[model samples]
Target: MSCLPVCTQRMKELAKERELEHGKRIEWNDWVADNLVVQFEKLVFPRRSQLPRASAVPHWEYSCQRLNHAFVRDEYSQLTLIPSVRENELVLQFHDFETMGQKSDGEIIFLDDITQAQALPSQDSVLHLLPAADEPQSAGYFCRFAIRDRSNANAACITPLNSGLLSRQDRWKRPRYAPSKPIVIDLSPRDLGLAEGFSQAEFDIIAGLGFDSEQDMSWRTRYPTATIYDESPPSVLSHMRRGKLLPPQDVKAGVPKVLIFSETGPLVIGGGEDPYFDLPLLNIINELNASEDDFDFLVSIQPAGILHPQCLPSFAKAVLELLKKRNSVHVFSVRLPDHGISNSQTYIVLLASPICSDVPWPATHLDTKSIEEQICHLKSKNPRADDTHPTAGKHVFLNPAGQVNVYNHGTGQLPDATDRPYFKTVDFESNIILPTLYSDHGWLHPTRHDILTVRECARIQGFPDDYIFYGADKALRSQIIASFPPPIARGIAEAIRKIIKEHTAPGLDASTFAALNLGGRPQKRTRVD
Candidate 1:
């Protein structure tokens, strides 16, 4: 495997890891190719006389690595883009690659001419950026290539086409047309890749992609679509205290939310595994304070020791001070006089989740009650999705169903990924206890069991199923499952933030702000025993 060694070595170098961190597994990489080109490029063409066989359109993908950095402090990210067939117009499809896996990046239809087209096509999606198994720094970059020449035994030489140059005639056609006399470009680069980690030069190179000076003005253009924001002011708790909220906010400027997800702790499959789950969240909070992108009307979410009630007021004060220089942005914290909420407008979203789904489910084999009877209330109001599915539920709609989850799928940064959690396996036999249900809808708790399955829990927490986790053992599994705050809760907080901003901003109607886009396919409900 000459190709394998090179590919493997190159990927490692890019990630900047000298050796594989303990428990880290490479997921897989995906290759993108055009279907029409695959047919035309073939030597044994179906005889014009032989009717085209009824079959799926030919398409292709190349294998990539899947690394579930379930416990790595520093994370790696990759972005892929595959454009559909079109004329000279520069239409681009984008994807965020935080996870590892062979994703279907979409088709790469070739065009004949550039000058021939009258208008650019609207964003015809291939796939949205999935969340990697790991979370990535908010400040990052991505690139994409069209897969070419997969037919060769040596797949290393495959290259992508530069859309900047194309002829006009090949842009469009009827059902009868095909790739006539044509040209092709190599999509893959000759070398695997060079250098590791971001430097000044590397950073600049990645940043320059689609460099547009006018992007600032277009950042948040006025659109007919109403914005979604968190309506309640943020709840800032101290980690030392580790509890709930004091009260509410009138303006609801900002609230610090703390999320507690159970995990197997840290693992070092190799020498030792090292992943700081809360690092990215912390970094983002710091950024919100330094910037003035209407970022104020939102409360910062963080990881307070045991819970969010313990979040420090010092952080809020510091953030407010940072915005002192900016004329528009200003976020402040509200103090409570007593035990209840300080004000009715205060918002506190306590996102608590188990590390996995080992929660002892009573009916390992269905008998009296249907699976719908096993549905998790915390996941959805619907009780029939997971347990009584097929009859009551159409598809799983527990927590995550966003274009954003695709961007974060497989790299193992996230603690509460749907497919894989931070800790997959935990020594149930080794632990001090056996399986038992912890709460109300309780059947038999799987140790990691709460109200939802792993995916169901992830969705409610705002993570797509494709997002992978780390920790392959039961102890680790439980840890990852319980460590995260629910995504639904986060989405709620996000909505609340936006609502507060709209109300505070002059002329913006409070009624309009209430119409935030937070709808999704509802989960089905079934009666459980």
Candidate 2:
């Protein structure tokens, strides 16, 4: 009989003793000799049926005194137990039966002398005893048994007393460590340019303009060659798609681009015998020179009507001519009525200039129309516009009691006394007026019933009180005042100046400088004598 069962029981008793008193000295050698013995007659041998007759079975003996170094033999194999006693531990080294007279690879059990705690050898010691299972025969040993040491106490014993190996879950839950690699990023020249050129406010606005929907992603995937300007106004996108107009994103910084804000009626489409495109262009260039001398030019054209599709060719031709002369030009259409002007008519503004290329073109065709639509939409939401007030109009009268009475038109009813102020009538007024003080449907003075004076109109349009109108006719003066608001012009000018300042300032990289000076034009430096 093998002594494994008795040795395991004695290990539990020694563990209890160690827990009770750590100073107790254990007689490990004596204990091993008394309890650790293997009887060959009573031990169950493997492959008993394959062994020779009972007489051919090799005889073996075991004594309690010599158990420290003993062997149990059978017909096929022998098991040798070699015990070594140290101050802290008792090592029981087992030899495999396969190799005769040689120390075949086997498990080494470490038993704590005080606690009799059983554990396998360390991983390093195990690897020293058994080589990696690269061969099919060696692989079987790994699959059948699990070798572990004190580092992992949950491992199964190799002895027949506990034949169970570690479960699959236990092996999977084992911790593993691996080396990590570094991360890297590469930025292009254009990316660097954008990074340096864009301020926080501009970056925020650009970020807001980016679309990240599945539909947008799918559209991008479908048209891999499309650019950011592909979905812009049809007029601009058509020119861009045909390689006539440069995509806004491709516009270079530092170089001045012509900005043209022109009305469609006078330049190309409206029934004008002689188009005054060059006059407006020259006027804007002069204005930019007077206001911002450092910049090349900013031209704003205010036309009387919306730009129709049929007029696009003429407009494109005009733009191409400007581009040929200026190298870059951005066009925009501005509507005066959308900007709090008393007039109700929409004016087309065309802006073409050599400003900062970093700034995107403002006022797409839809954007211009959408502003008017939104204003009109808000007006339509007024309560007085409802069908219930079919006779509603801006007609006010003073009753004998000094209260304001409103007269309902087309209702055949007398004026009714109302608590609502007279100014509220303006809220329901939807008359579209031209840029003239004497127009029948034009703005009325807030306190008086007379039309707004030319000076008042100019003030409403962001002009200073002292600003003089050179035109002799009131209508002509009104037209001048209504063309473009001074505040908006100042804002656009300041923005252009800011863009130029940021892009052309010193300290930028050589690549950025090359990018800004697109034509490889040599810088004009003063000759030092």
Which 10-residue window of candidate 2 scores lowest in summed lDDT? 181-190
Tens digit of per-residue lDDT, candidate 2, span 79-184: 2223333422112222231221222333322222122222233322221111112224332112212211121111111211011122332221111111111010
Give stretches of model 2 more than 4 Å off. Answer: 1-295, 304-306, 309-311, 353-356, 360-447, 469-476, 506-529
Q: Tell me the spans in candidate 1 whose CA falls farther than 4 Å from its real position.
A: 1-294, 306-453, 456-529
Measured against the true structure, the TM-scores of the candidates, in listed sequence, are 0.21, 0.30
lDDT of 2: 0.31
Residue 510 accuracy (lDDT) in model 1: 31
lDDT of 2 at 34: 40
Q: Candidate 1 lDDT (Cα, whole model)?
A: 0.23
Q: In model 2, what is the error at residue 415, expressed in angstroms?
A: 27
lDDT of 1 by residue, 1-529 (tens): 3699987777657444412321232200000012212322331112122223343344342222232212111222222213233322222221211111223333222222111222112222122121111223333222222222222221111111222211342111111111111110101101001000011111111111111223211111211121212111121212101334222122212111111211112212222123332332343334433322222122222222212212223333333342231211111111111111111111111211101001111111112221222222222323453554533432233343333332211111223222222223322232111121111111222342422344433332223344443322233223322332223223333333333333233443434333431111111244232
